[model samples]
Target chain A: MGESLRIYAKLVGAQGRAQASYRTSFWLDLIGSSIIVGADLIAVLVIFSRVPALGGFSISQTLVFFGIALTAFSIADLVVGNIERMRNYVRMGTLDAMLIRPLGVLPQLLANDVGFRRAGRVVYAGAVYVVALSYADIDWTPGRVVLVVSAPLFGAVFFAAFFVATATVAIWWVESGELANALTYGGRDLTSYPISIYGGWFRRMFAFGLGFAFVAYYPGLALLGDPDPLGGPAWLGWASPLVGIAASGVAALIWRTGVRHYRSTGS
Target chain B: MGLVTATTDRVTIRNFAEFASLIGAIAASGFRRFWTYRQATVAALATNTMFGFLRTYVMLAMAALTPVVAGYTGPQLAAYVWTGQGLLGVVMLWGYADLADRIRSGDVVTDLLRPIHPVLNYLAVDLGRAAHGMIFRFLPPVAVGVIVFDMYLPQDLSTYPLFAISVLLAVIVCFACRYLVNASAFWLLDHRGVVMVWLFVSGLFGGLYFPIRFLPQWAALLIWLGTPGPSMLQAPMDIFVERDPFRVQLAIVGVQVFWAVLMLWACHVVQRRAERKMVIQGG
Candidate 1:
């Protein structure tokens, strides 16, 4: 395990060097991505102010939600920046090199490109969360603080699992790249919102089927000291991280199956 | 001479068959490509989905203040948010990234040498991707929206024709605007900064994140006429919601034609100037 981690570190270092090599393009991308997401967030805040309160939540509460979701997303992008390049690796036949490396293949793949572009997102999210903390009415408890930090970790694991699952299918088929994007990108798009607004059945699918609700919505409910937006049991919020872990496990199993299949297929 | 003509005809047929077969192959390959990188696909989808979640929460929080704004309910608002997010992958006709890369790599010259008109080829490629993207990106969100919220699909059958026309117009206008932005690369060389400004301005004027109707009346009117964002998105949404066939049809087709003609003229002017500039720079 330690050897695997060391290998992962070295791979990550190489990717970081690659990004540093193109300083201008890297900075431009980082700024551009940040501006795009920042604009979206500001637009929401502006529009929300025009209305009384969105979906029965106060401005303060909404701010907290955004803060939490953005924080999780930034961290996810930061860690899995390299994994997102699975398609390019597959198309370029670079995955073969990683497979030949002495370490576990997944770690090398995961560490290949830690996206510094997401640094902008992480900075912005951290700022928003700080601002939210200053204003939000939630009780200040050790448990709450732990949940805030850990929420993003679980969110990252859950999302990374989604990424791995999508890429594993590449072992069998090349065109699966676009199809896999539907799940990962589609899930990200769906989860950024308050899950309750999507209606009960949609929430149920995320909660029970895809298991994304655990990372954001249910935990969000627990943080708010409120019932689940989709009428789920209140206790599920505390247990939501387990769902994230389980999703990761399922992704790993699928990945193993896909890798075995790949070995057999000789692609 | 007769034999030569017959052989030429045969060659043309064979080339057409090859082209058709290539397209089919790419389509088939796209599916497997997506399946293979399934987790990465999920990550991309999750990125979009996460945005949807944040926007929905914001919209829901806003709906608490008012029930109806511009004739849309809370669920309808949520539908628009998710649908627009879905459309991002579809309507990505002209990404500034490509323009920057092409310019930096000096590949724009080769693009000019293509026999079939560079602009048309670009449009064709974009349309193909948009066609595929519209299916995969949108179907899930729309389906989820329908099953979850029962958001209204057009009830008036006649409105479907109007929607189709509006969508076609939207596509043309969007493509033209993209070309205009890309053409800037010829002059700017490094269009990164300029494209950023353009995107920021368009997002505001285009009703990308929120409908222009939410803007104050005078500001919204200015946006409607000039920015071309409403033409790309809001007009279609209007058709879906109001089904005001006469006004909707007129608005879509008329504006699309105007933008297409205007943009083509701009492109012609730019093309001449850019050719001269490139010769001077030995680009």
Candidate 2:
């Protein structure tokens, strides 16, 4: 395990150096990536303008939802953004390059690019979260404070798992990148708003079928002290960290299955 | 003297024929190139269609909250969401770096050294791409939309021609701005950063998320400063919805025309400077 970590570190360092090689481009991408905030802003503003609240949460509360979602996704993007490139590697038969390496394919794949460029999104999300924290109007409690502080870590791991699982599926069918996007990007969009705003089928599919709601929604409910409009217990929000662990486990299992299948098929 | 004039006239006619054929070949090739990526086109269409569903619902919900939110009713909002996706492909803004790659590889020198204009070449290709996208990528989302919600066709007979003109002008404006972005490759080591900045701001100011009307009033006003942000994707979609009066539609189209001309002029100026300062350092 230590050896695998060391190898991962080395690969990450190489990618970091390669990215840092272009100083201006790196900075530009970091700042430019934050522009997605505009889209989010538009959604929030347009929805709230007609009404003061959505799904019993105020505009500031929805902003917190977006902030938490953005923070976690940005952290995931920084570490495992290269998972999105798995389609190319699989289609081009370049997965063999990593397979031939002495390192475990998972570690190498996880460390593939370690997108430093996403630093912009991280900083941007952090700033937005700070704004949300001030505006949410929630009472301060020790346990809640802990969850708020550590929310990003849980979010990062949960989303990293999502990205890995998405990439794993690419090994079988490379053309399903858009479908994968419908999950990751769609999930991000889903979680960034009030859960009750979605249709019944969508809410059920995300909560029970894909299990994306555990990654953010229930935990956000706990943080906000709001009851789950979908009839889940509000106390289930404390499971944020647990959800991260479960996501990691599921991702690991999916990845192992995909790798085994690839070895057997040699495709 | 008569013989000289006759020969000159013959040569001029032949040159015109050659130029027209060149543009035709480039445009045709551009159209055919997209066919090779049928999977990508299908995937993009699927994604757009899904987003249309999600966005329409959101807009409808917003309308429920307030009877007339952002000058759109429920059915109009559905039509807006679906048609907006199609318009996105037709205008088709992206951050590509063909010129940067050429410049980096020292191939741009030869490209510039060609007798024909480079910006015009790219514009021709883009026109062909827009045509292809309109056929395959644009209409499918709207087709999917019809089943989900009733569409709003404008009561005015002239809105169709006006909308078509608005769309054509917007595509020109989009391509022109992109040309200027690509032109930056001549001076900067990494113009990709600039392209990202362009995309970032454009995604917001271009009114992709919602109409520019929804922006904080200050941002809405500031959207028109130096760049032609709204003219790209927003103007055409807004025109199709017929949210504005005839005079307002005319004004919006006028703005699009102005931006298209301004961006094209900037491309010409930048190319001239880039050629003057041409330096081929390494491959």
Candidate 3:
């Protein structure tokens, strides 16, 4: 484990230096991503400006979900996004080289192109989160504090699992980018709003079927100490962190199966 | 008329006609380029369809909050979402940094040396792409929307012609705005940043998000961003929903036309200036 950690640090350090070489591009990327967050924030602000609430949640409350979702997704994207390149690597027959490496295939891929450009999203998400907490009007309690603090941590795990599992799917179907987007980008967009606002089928598919609801919505309810407006116990919100663990386990199994399939087929 | 002057006049008319035909050919080629990309168009259509449903729900949900928010009735809001999805690709209302890439690769010099006006040629290509987008990208999404959401259309035959005219103008304005964004690459060198910002704000001001009218605070500000931004997607769309009176809708088209002219003029000026300052970087 110590050796693995050292290798990762070295790889990331090298990658960071390369990225730092393009000073202007680096700044532009940061600002470019921040603009996306800015646009979403504007949409939310505009909608709330006309409506008192959406799905029985106030604008401030909605921000808590948005904040958690964005931050968590940002964390997941910055790290596991490299895994998505597995498609191209596989197609180019580069996996043969990776398979020969003494270090694990997952770590090498994870450390291949680590970048800080996602910090742009982090900046905006952090800002929105801070603003949300300020206006959240929640009673201060230790349990709530811990939940709020850990929300992004759990959400990141949940999202990272989504990315890894989706990337694993790329081993079988190289054209899985769009299908994968249904969970990654699509799921992120879905989580930005209160799930109760969505229709019954839409709610069922994303919330319960995919378990993405654990990433932000359920966790958000837990932090707010609010009941689930979608006819479920409010405490269902606390299940996200556990769901994140479960997702990671499933993602691992899928990744192993994919690797085994690749080796057996020797493609 | 003198023999030389008469000959010159004849030559000038012939040249103008030839140029028009050249542009038409380029436009056709542009159309074919988009049509050829069958998979990309389908993939993009799928994404747009997905967003169409999401936005429809979001818009209707917002409309449900108030019987009317910013003069958009629930049906009107639904119309806006579905039609916006159709027009999204048709307008290509996003940053186009192709000129920046050309500049980076030194290919822009070839364009500069061409006898044709660079802006006009690019406009031809874009118009062709827009036509292709309308046929392939716009129709599929709208058909789905009509089936699923009961999207609105004008009852009057007159409205169709006017809407068509508005859509054409919007396409022109969209092209001009994108051209201008690309032109800035000559000066900025790193045009992606500029293009990114343009695309990000255009959706807000361009009515890809909620209607600009919903943004009372920002409506004046958006209008002040000058003509092309609002004239492109937002105005044509406002006309589509029949949210405005006929004359008012005609006036929106008028805004689009006026901006299209101004923006086209602006593109020519930028191309001329870029040629003057021709600095080739990292070919």
- Output the number of the lDDT-best candidate: 3
Candidate 2 residue lDDT tens string, B51-145: 77667767766766777666767677777788788877787877346677887787776565444677877878888888898889778998888
DockQ of each: 0.18, 0.53, 0.45
Any residue pairs clashing in model 2, and if so which? none
After superposing candidate 1 on the true structure, give the runs of residues whose Cα lies further than 4 Å from its correct spot.
A1-7, A46-55, A229-235, A263-267, B1-67, B73-117, B120-162, B184-208, B243-245, B248-253, B281-283
The better candidate by lDDT, 1 or 3, is 3
Query: What does candidate 3 score on TM?
Result: 0.89
C-alpha RMSD over true interface residues, model 3: 2.3
Docking quality tier of model 3: acceptable
Please provide, for model 2 over A106-205, each residue's C-alpha lDDT reduced to its tens digit, 9 standing for 90 to 100: 7777688688888888888888888887888878789889888777778788888888888887778767646566666766776777666767676677
Interface Cα RMSD of candidate 1: 5.1
In model 1, state the lDDT of residue A208.
Answer: 65
- Candidates ranked by DockQ: 2, 3, 1
Worst 10 residues of 2 chain A by lDDT: A258-267
Candidate 3 residue spans exceeding 4 A from truth: A82-100, A167-182, A253-267, B1-17, B221-227, B279-283
User: At residue B100, what lDDT does model 1 achieve?
Assistant: 46
Interface RMSD of each: 5.1, 2.2, 2.3
Candidate 2 ranges beyond 4 A from true positions: A35-39, A42-50, A175-179, A239-246, A263-267, B1-21, B113-115, B150-155, B216-226, B279-283
Candidate 1 docking category?
incorrect
**On TM-score, who's better, 1 or 3?**
3
